[model samples]
Target: MAKFKIDINANKHFTGELSPVFSVAEARKASQFHKGLQGYEPTPLRDLSSLAEMMGVKGILVKDESYRFGLNAFKMLGGVYAIARLLCEEFGWGIEQFDFDKLKNEVDEKMTFATTTDGNHGRGVAWAAEQLGQNAIVYMPKGAAEQRVKNIRSHGAECIVTDMNYDDTVRMVAEKAQQNDWKIVQDTAWEGYTDIPTWIMQGYSTMAVEAIEQIAEQGLPKPTHVVLQAGVGAMAAGVLGYLAEELGASDLKAIIVEPDQADCIYRSGSSEKGEMINVGGDMATIAVGLACGEPNPLSWDVLRNCSSHFVSVEDKVPALGMRVLGNPLAGDERIVSGESGAIGTGLLAAVHFSDNKAELMQSLNLNEDSVVLLLSTEGETDPVNYRDVVWQGKYSSI
Candidate 1:
């Protein structure tokens, strides 16, 4: 039994007005900015028809971000774009006037870019810094996988494994960056630190743009429900922003999923005015990437207004999702999704297969006619752990 907590956002008051924080035009601009980068390409959108039938949905479309920029994660779209924008500002050049070679040559050696991550985000930051010819310092939470640390270091970043939880590490890195005058390219936002994080969120909108375009090209109908995995709600807000613009807020259901151990978004959505809430302590979940204790305030506004539901699932849920994707039944194609990447599918499975199916399905308004979209945000970023979970069926040990 996968333990889960779900909340229907009673404070979700969408007056049919789009989010003011991000727009479709900004998302398109971000996509254009990404296209100017070296390895810019749209990741594959796979149709998991077999899985959809098994889950009793009309269809399931998954945006496989495992192939994104060889980073095995969608975070590069955000990190790289944020880095470029920061460099453009620092060099006093317009976006089109920006030249990577010139910036690389003129960049100060003492200037170091920094961020805190569970894994993929730090790798994206390190990879972006390497591409831009700048130094990067990445901080990871205490229990971060060794393979992830090595991946970050492979991009020539100074990787530090901090003896803190994910949220504490983020706070530590932010404070140290401020004290040392290093530029912090974080995905999460708080007061007075909203610009870069907003840029990061805007950059993430590129993925949604690509997915929407791909769905159109394939002649498929717009998805009725979008299940997004949330860590501070940046990616979810980005996707929701674009979709809410293209398809009105009432046309689709936007669901946010997070680790039960780090249910900040769930708590916030359940609050009186969707107020920001903090979950303090060591959040131990196999879905390490979503192990954030606090919701990003900038993203909170977008999510509270546009998103319909917030879900928090136990660790076993994602493990089971990984297994399901890895061992596809019959005609279903195999998908290599990591712990964090598979949570959306996991949440779907938990709700659909659990004993409380009727209540859960009715809450999300899911039915056989509903078309569902899931974002598999990463591949097997950690191979050893992936092997254990998928092949060995070792959910508890993880």
Candidate 2:
């Protein structure tokens, strides 16, 4: 197994300051927008008490995004909501006044939505475009699985496999969108491109809102710690923003997990404020969805303050988590988590099982009384890889 690395944020402080950009109220509004869409239902928040016991934690709650909008991933929430907001703005109609059917009928065929992704996010963009009756152009990074490219195309969007890494592909698409006048509905934000990505982050708050309500309905105490996996940190920011609102920042421990090879967030957290660091190279990780080389600028603000700890694990870590979730200890419900989805749980397992367990556990304040929450962000986005890892016990050679 590959060794894990942890970085305690130097500037980590729980200010209890509500984020103006992403708040519980904003998330609630985003959730309302999602409710108007077809196939809108809250995904399950599973109680993995047995797994908690195994890890010696008080409780372990997992919000499974496998069932989200039939896409087997959570990106649809962001993609669709951003598309809606973009349409509303373009048509000069308020969200409440905008009609989907009317927009679909009148939407200009020349208007196209475009984005870049490793897999799930591209499919989400394509799905959103199909729903809105708009054309979509999706670009995927080199070495992206064929199944993922096909999934994007299945949504009636034009899918292109590019000979570039994730970040480069994103830049390429952005430039092309600007040149061709296609609307860019990306989830990651840069300078002067914050508005739509902010909307995307707000949309992701729906998952957090649903999880909090589900926990309350089940009479479970609010999670003492939340472990979120990051690509560009959009989902992490949204979850942290909502949780910081509900459970004060000081009361909750927020951990950001990423692939060691693609540890941009970890590097960013360790750097000086406003300093951008790139975790360069191919970012070859089994968890393709979290293989981002850079942190989203907008998300960095929330993550830098709200996140207490950052952990970067090797590909073996999430592979182990996929196996553990797929074939849980007796009495534990099975969770079909894809490579990206299982990293949070994998990080927890690594800490508990490592030789430096005592020190690492103490650093994160993980104890028997700790209530941990995790978001399983995708489910078998690449089935061939999933089967090899889960059934054959093969570690990704990538």
Candidate 3:
């Protein structure tokens, strides 16, 4: 059996239905806002040229988001922006008129922000709330890492662990938030709740803005392809939306990847109707960040129209990616990518080394001239798990 499930999005095309929020112009505004934060720096976009040559691609650029806000992940970009936007709305102030310091000084009421997360997003929300002397309540699904819970609580948030899985916990948190009037900073959008998620997605577009700008500065050609990993499609959609608007969809071939266990976006894209798909149960997977089963309805629209292909791969794929990045080729910078962070690299490596590279390469439109872009969305958030994969070779297919 194939270790991968490659699905062509028959509905994929340039629909020109780009949301105003993801316009490159708007994303630049968000990036400017993030720059106004206390400690803001654009993460490094590494040129994995040697790896690209081995894979028979012209060039490969991986945006290492491990350095984002000292958080070891890119989740905070969304959390901080959504939280800031919430405060701006509540105070009747324009975002452009206030910097981080001004916003912090102006907050009179201590507001509570609530959200459900696996690990990264909760810590992000808690960090954002703590920065402005506000409160946060973070709900985590069952089997959430204790280290993750402690990380959130370290930021002064009340971290709650529940017996439910990620998606179920989201529903439960929504009920409690309604009862307590807590502002939900979730990335997944649903009926009657979209503005915060929209803000979060827009915040995520800063990555796209930075990556494209960095490519130009490095004298590299624009990326012909992007390999994005998705959970609820928030991060993937957010980045892809901005790229499509800025680069023009005609030139970029986008691919969305997810773990086989919880590939909601892949399933939805492959489905005939291309509607929202939900996967329920204990979403057991080593790539915990990509184990989400519910597709964000808002992001689903963008992926359906803006992306070229979707692939769901085994845990071994990400395992290989982690090892390759940790042990880089000569003259290339080493990256300590976590399980969720390294999958894009892993998927590319798999396609290169697979026995049927011809078929797989043709399917993905990857070749000697393809300029690929990958986002290493995190670093070693879970040291134990990272060691298990990289040191022990726990899921190495070989």
Best by TM-score: 3
lDDT of 2 by residue, 91-168 (tens): 798876657789877765646999999999889989988887888999999999999999999999999999899999
Candidate 2 clash pair list = none
TM-score of each: 0.95, 0.95, 0.96
TM-score of 3: 0.96
Q: For model 2, what is the alpha-carbon lDDT of residue 181?
A: 93
Error of model 1, residue 342, in angstroms: 0.3
Candidate 2's C-alpha runs over 4 A off are 1-16, 108-110, 272-274, 396-398
> Which stretches of model 1 miss by more than 4 angstroms?
1-16, 106-110, 396-398
In what order do the candidates fall by lDDT, top score first?
3, 2, 1
lDDT of 3 at 393: 84
Per residue, candidate 3 scores C-alpha lDDT tens digits across 1-398 of 22543334434533646766667887888899998887899999999989988889899999999999889999999998888888888888788865667756766778899999999999999999888788999999888877888889999999999999999999999999999989899999989999999999999888989999899998998899999999999999999989987887767888899998899988887777677778888889889998899999889889888888888888888888999999999978999999999999989888777778788888888888899999999998888889988998888677
RMSD of each: 2.1, 2.1, 1.7
Evaluate model 3: give its lDDT: 0.88
